[model samples]
Structure formats: C-alpha cells, structure tokens
Target: MAFLKTIREVGKYFHDIYSGVASLMRGMKVTGSYFTRPGSIVTQRYPENRDTLKMFDNFKGELMLIHDENNLHSCNVCNTCARKCPNGSIEIIYKKVEGADGRSKKILDKYVYHLDTCSFCGLCVPACDELALKFDQKFEHAVFDKRKLTKVLNKPGSSSKTTNE
Candidate 1:
C-alpha cells in the first residue's frame, strides 16, 4: 500500500510538470505567431505617426469650451459643471452683466480648469445643459509647472445668450 501511494504521488508530480510545460508552450506559440504576422502587431511608432494617428471619437482627453465664430459660448454660468465635478477641477468666476433686458444676468468672467486635479471622468460635459462643454482630443497636456495646468476655458470676448434676452 505504501509503494502504491508513492507511485501515485510521483504520477501527480509529473502531471503538474507536464501541465506547466504545455501552458508555457501555448503562450510561446501565441508570441511566435505575433512575430511572424507583422499585421497582427499593433505597436505604434510615436511622434513619427503623429499626423496619421487618429483618435477615436469617444476618446476623452481633456475638457474644453466650444466657442463659436462670433465668440459666443453656450455656458450659462449655472455652476452645474463646477458642482458636478467629482474632484472640484472646475472653478467658475462670473459677474453680473446687464443683458438685452433691463435685468442683470450672470456672465462668465473666468472659467478656471485645473487639469492636474481632474480625473477625466467626463461628468462636466453632460452636466452642462447648454451643451457648451466638450472633450478636446489633443492629449499632450504635460507642463513643466503645476500652475500652468490651470486653464481658462472661456475665451476672451466670449459670452452666452441670456435666457431673458
């Protein structure tokens, strides 16, 4: 009975070794196929393919305000985007401006966007009911200084149409 138990243990050990070797060979086979099939490899050469490199439509890189040709933006300064931000990346500063009507309305003065703090969760875009916000595809946002990461999204001379107007 002891000799039979020893034989069973040896058989189990050999099976484990065989299973490991078979798994290793399977992985190596996949690697070998990739080497032979050049088209199967999707490794991109950076900088050289910059012009041809196409970003997907759904790719979320950074948030930017859409300013029209007339320098008119759709942001209503409702503070929805700032409030919806999970990381408090958006800081909006606005002052009351007299609209076409006699009453005063809040117009965007400064839209501070801290990129470093932003998690790129894409909450701010949908929070804007005006559809003024969008993700900018240009992903090269690296800067030498942390202060430089803070960006003002509202362009100069850009204003939104007042609801009362």
Candidate 2:
C-alpha cells in the first residue's frame, strides 16, 4: 500500500511538470516571434550616437557652481551642501569680509568638489536657496589623474571685497 502511494505521488509530480513546460513554451513562442522582428530589437549605440541623444531634465550628472561674469558665485559659504553631502566630497571654505553695513559677511572662499567621490545626488542643489549650485548636462568627467577630478568650479579673483567698514 505504501509503494502504491509513492508511485501515485510521482505520477502527480510529472503531471504538474508537464503543465509548467507547456506554459513556458507558450511564453517562449511570443518571445521567438519578437526576436525575428527587426522593430522589436531595442538596443542603442550610446557613444556613436551621443549627439542625437537628449538627457532628461531631472537627470543628475555633475554639480557645477554657477558663476557670474564678475566671477562671483551666489554661494554665501553657508556650508549647507558640504554638511549634507553623504560622501564628504564637497568642501566649502568660508571667507569673512566686512559687509556694506559694517557687519561681517560669510563669503565663499573656495569650493572644493571631488567628482570621484560624489554620488551625483541633487540634495546639495535645493539646500542652497541662492541657486548657486546646478547640475551641468556635460557628463564626460574622465581624467587620467585622480587629482584632476578634484576641481574648484569658481573662477579665480571673483570675490569682491567691501571696504565700507
């Protein structure tokens, strides 16, 4: 009686296996048709056709400091982005200067950004209400040396000094 029950269980297992195989074959038939169709293939040559491609507005690439023609960036050196960066890749040096009202104003000294360690998260952008930071669509950041990856986005001699005090 035990042997008969074991044999009955084995027969039931094969019945289920055949059902699964049939289901798989049905799915494969649809895929096989698509494989033969030229329009169904969805692969793009990225490097060769880069000029024709368009990046999404929200796509996070590289962070850049937007500097005006005067070489002054909108960043007040609040260090909001440096503190919020998860990788500690951003370093903002604050320069103390006398404001027109005779009060000391915290100005951006140097903005050191390490592209190698940046996660490309846009958290740093909105944290700056001054709109000093923005993501540039240019993503070709490869460099031969690691030191080259560390960049100061702000132009030299852009900081204006207030002598009102």
Candidate 3:
C-alpha cells in the first residue's frame, strides 16, 4: 500500500511538470511567430524621417511667446507662468513701459526659458491667461554644448512681426 501511494504522487508531479512545459512552449511559439514576421516590427528611424513623423496633438514640446502684427506679445508680465512652472525653468522679467496712450504697462523685459531644465509641461501655457504662450512642435533640440540648450524663444524688440511679414 505504501509503494502504491508513492507511485500515485510521482504520477501527479509528472503531470504538473508536463503542463508547465506545454504552457511555456505555447508562449515561445507566439514570440517565434512575431520574430519571423518582418512587417510586425514597431521601431521607426526617428531622425532620418522626422518630416513624416507626427507628434500627439497635445504633446508638450517647447514653450514660445507668440508675437502679433503689432510687434507685441499678449503677455502682461503677470508672472503666473513662472509661479506655476513645476521645474522653475521659466523666468519673466517685467519692465514698466509707457504705452502709446502714455499709460505705464507691465511689459516683458526678458523671457528666459531653460529648455534643459524644462519638463515640457503645458501648465505654463494655460496659466498665461493672455494666450501669449504656445507649444511649438520643433523637437530637434539636441545640442553639442549643454549651455546652448538654454535659449530665449522670443526675439527682443521684434515681437510684433506677423507670419506673412
């Protein structure tokens, strides 16, 4: 009776081992099929075909200040974007300037954006309220010198040129 019980236990162990092997083989077969199918490869050459590539509509790329036809950006130097930036990459300096009506308005003296430290979060854009900021989809930002990555997106005193101009 003892020997008969030992044989039953061995049979059960072998059955379990066979089931595990069968499951493993099934998984391997799926992987093997994928390897043989050249059309199933999901990798794309990024730099070689950047023009054909498309980014998400909401993809956060880089922050830019939009200049209207009047050579002026809508940013009122509210500093809301600088405060809301999680990475502290945005620095806006406000300068008091007299408008054509002789009224002093807070204008942006300097808009410094450190692209290296920027998280590319769109939080700053909406926080602007004036719609002065936007995400530009130019992602070819790689540079040999890290310092070159820090840039001022807006040109000084030339913010009013329209796209046609």
Name the weakest run of 10 consecutive residues (lDDT summed) in model 2: 156-165
lDDT of 3: 0.78
Note each model's CA RMSD in angstroms. Answer: 4.1, 5.1, 4.1
TM-score, cand. 3: 0.71
lDDT of 2 by residue, 9-77 (tens): 999999899999999999999888888997977666556556876788776778888877766667767
- The residue pairs in collision within model 3 are 71-160
Model 3 Cα lDDT, one tens digit per residue, 80-161: 9999999999988667767667777666668899999997767898897778889977778788999987777667675422
Spell out the clash pairs found in candidate 1.
none
lDDT of 3 at 26: 100
Off by over 4 Å in 2: 1-36, 68-72, 157-165
Regions more than 4 Å wrong, model 3: 42-48, 68-72, 94-97, 103-105, 138-144, 160-165
Query: Count of backbone clashes for each model?
Result: 0, 0, 1
Model 1 alpha-carbon drift over 4 Å, by segment: 1-37, 163-165
Of 1 and 2, which scores higher on TM-score?
Answer: 1
Tens digits of per-residue lDDT, candidate 1, 102-133, equal 77888888999999999999999988888999
